[model samples]
Target: MTKLGLEAKDLEPTRTIFHSIVSGFSCSPIGRIRLDLFGDSSHFRREPIWFEVVDLSSAYHALLDRPALAKFMAVPHYAYLKIKLPGPKGLITVTDDYRKSIESARDGAKLAESLVVAEERRQLDRIVALAQEASTAPIPAEDPADKTSFKPSKETKKVKLNPEDPSCSKYVVMGSRLDNK
Candidate 1:
């Protein structure tokens, strides 16, 4: 619209909302406009298209949907990366750059990965905040009379390692509950 020297006031108000499968959200269109689209010098189409003005950055300026294709009576061949439509003189065919398409796909993949990482970071931040909150809470002191305290069940006797050297003697504690086998 800016490129064509058109302002927001020029657009016809639209109440329609559309969903993006890739972004997983719904967006209300800014407005609708009947723009003259040219396939070539001979083949041209005038279609009313709804424009969703997003705040976020994108790789592509505009993404045409099935409705736009249907209006032009265009058939897209994905394998050949071409769109064909009936022209007044003959068949109007538009070809896409293979390298540019690959580049765009790569950029889209990167954007998706970055979004996932950002979401994961947000979750981790929430978990950290919860942990910090938990850590700040006061803990009760353990009671000496608690029955859950660990205790050895067997009685033991101590035997000195060196009987001749009493000062250097080290004693080993042996349990009476030992089996002879």
Candidate 2:
């Protein structure tokens, strides 16, 4: 495995390993342990969390030459010296950018659905308002010769219904249906 750079004490602080696979190679981020022997536990404990390199596809490696491949293959499993970078103090998390974009698209679709439902609700309310207006508005006066002409009246007619009759009791009067004496 030494040919593949796997050796004793091969493990070290802030080191990354590129595992050779049948298809290609895969590597992860390298991090070092904190050596705060004299300090408190806050600075002593450490976790092994590595962030994988981005866009390291098989097609990308296929484009590289022998010398370049050998150089990359020789990378030590651990960092030989002190390694420090700016930004995140702990392990850096890496994720697929394409996946993130897909999630954002799904969120946008859900928002669009909700907006469509709201617009439909507003349309229904408008139709209901129009119906109410049509019901209460005064009818236009017709020609005196029109036999079908009917006059609008504010007076409501009361119908005498037998309380003991099942048919009359079961039926409910609504609007002007019972108002035309």
Best-fitting candidate, scored by lDDT: 1
C-alpha positional error of residue 92 in candidate 1 after TM-score superposition, expressed in Å: 1.9
Question: What would the per-residue lDDT of candidate 1 be over residues 99-129, giving only the tens digit for each residue?
Answer: 7878877877787677768878999999999
Q: What tens-digit string does per-residue lDDT give for candidate 2 at 17-48? A: 55542223344533322221111234322323
Q: Give me the runs in candidate 2 sitting further than 4 Å from their true place.
A: 1-96, 144-181
Query: CA RMSD for every model?
Result: 8.5, 21.6
lDDT of each: 0.70, 0.41
